[model samples]
Target: MNQAFRDLFGAKVAGAVASAKALGQVDHSGLKGALREVLVRSLLRPFLPPSIGVGHGIVISAYDDQSTEQDIVIFNRASLPCILIDEESGLFPLESTLFTIEVKSRLNATELEKTHEKAARLEKLRHTPGETTPEHVIPCLFAFETDLVQKTDLHRYQELIGTSDPSIREICVVGQGRWFWTPQGWHHTPPTDTYSEVAGLIDGISSVYERVQATRSRPLLLNYVD
Candidate 1:
């Protein structure tokens, strides 16, 4: 808002980024991944309505197969046949999940490829009762920074991943930009500033919140298998 607050906010973001980079050098650990995931989950959960929750879980099939562990799961936990939990982790019904997200402190081609693979697995899982394709569940990838995908390289990456898995619908590289697909196709909004990126990131998710809620199907005529 004010120049003083802007400067303070910039300094804070820089500090957080520096901390994440330092954690990255420590090797494979939650220290590196959890920071981003927790921040994103906390920031995003409130933007969604009270009916939705943000947490970690997997989508499951009727036969008991499961999707890979999601970094964040936005779901309607109140819905029966949607969530089941045990000593380890929770499982979410594909129909009840509004979206799944993978968060990275930094994104690279390797991480990007792995993210796609996970998405493919989720795409293959069957939906709850009346639901069809996993296209209703938005796939998203978020990063604090990146060494992988970029504007100059986006075309090639898009071509490389073509028609393989359901593609990520929203990509927000904090302090960088937000990329998303629409009826008009792929659109990229380059970062204006850290504040704008933060705004855009939340706003991008907010749009999905509105969209999924708007188009959500009501399960009628339930014939309980149990």
Candidate 2:
């Protein structure tokens, strides 16, 4: 809020971006997965309240449709039940998911298109209306580098991603230094802009899931383990 604090926060975000860049330079695939975990641990998990949780999992609707494994999934386990969970994967209840993120080691058309399709599929899964939770789940795509998209042509990418869907929000090419959102348009920045963008995400998350804890919904369950 204050100028002094703002400057401090900016420095921290800048540090995260710098760290990701260094990690991805050599082992783009392996280390990038590590970077995704880092982003979750630093940018997301800390911000998530106790009632809610963040994980890398797939969403499962009542119809048995399963989603592509997402890099980051913010769900309220305190309120809803998980359809399945094992050592390898977690199949979450669709309505329980509040937000989902797709992570990429680099930004390219192929990756972008795939992410778009995945988000669209998630959008089609209808939620079971019970308690009043956040009506729309925010879908986000974040990358550590860019190979196809140029900083100046963010609008071109936006057109490809489409604007009609409320479930999906925007593509944050943090390593490339730009982001495209249907509502706010494009944000062009330097390659090391990951932290600042993450800060924006925190603000958005706070506003969207602000009321979730007040209406925590729990389902009937039987827990047994060997």
Compared with the true structure, what per-residue lDDT tens digits does model 1 show for residues 1-226? 6888667655655666677777778877776676767666656765667777777778765556678999888876555445447422477766567788898887777888788788777777655444432346788887778774445324534865875433677777776667777777777777765556655666776666656645545453252233
Lowest summed lDDT over 10 consecutive residues: which window, candidate 2?
217-226
Measured with C-alpha atoms, the lDDT of residue 136 in candidate 1 is 68
Cα-lDDT of candidate 1: 0.67
Give lDDT: candidate 1, residue 223.
24
Q: Which residue pairs overlap in candidate 2's backbone?
A: 79-217
Among these predictions, the greatest lDDT belongs to: 1
Q: Which stretches of candidate 2 lie over 4 Å from their true place?
A: 28-31, 83-89, 129-134, 148-154, 161-167, 175-195, 211-226
Q: TM-scores across all candidates? A: 0.77, 0.73
Candidate 1 regions with alpha-carbon error over 4 angstroms = 1-16, 63-65, 81-89, 129-135, 148-153, 163-166, 218-225
How many clashes does each candidate structure show, in the order listed? Answer: 0, 1
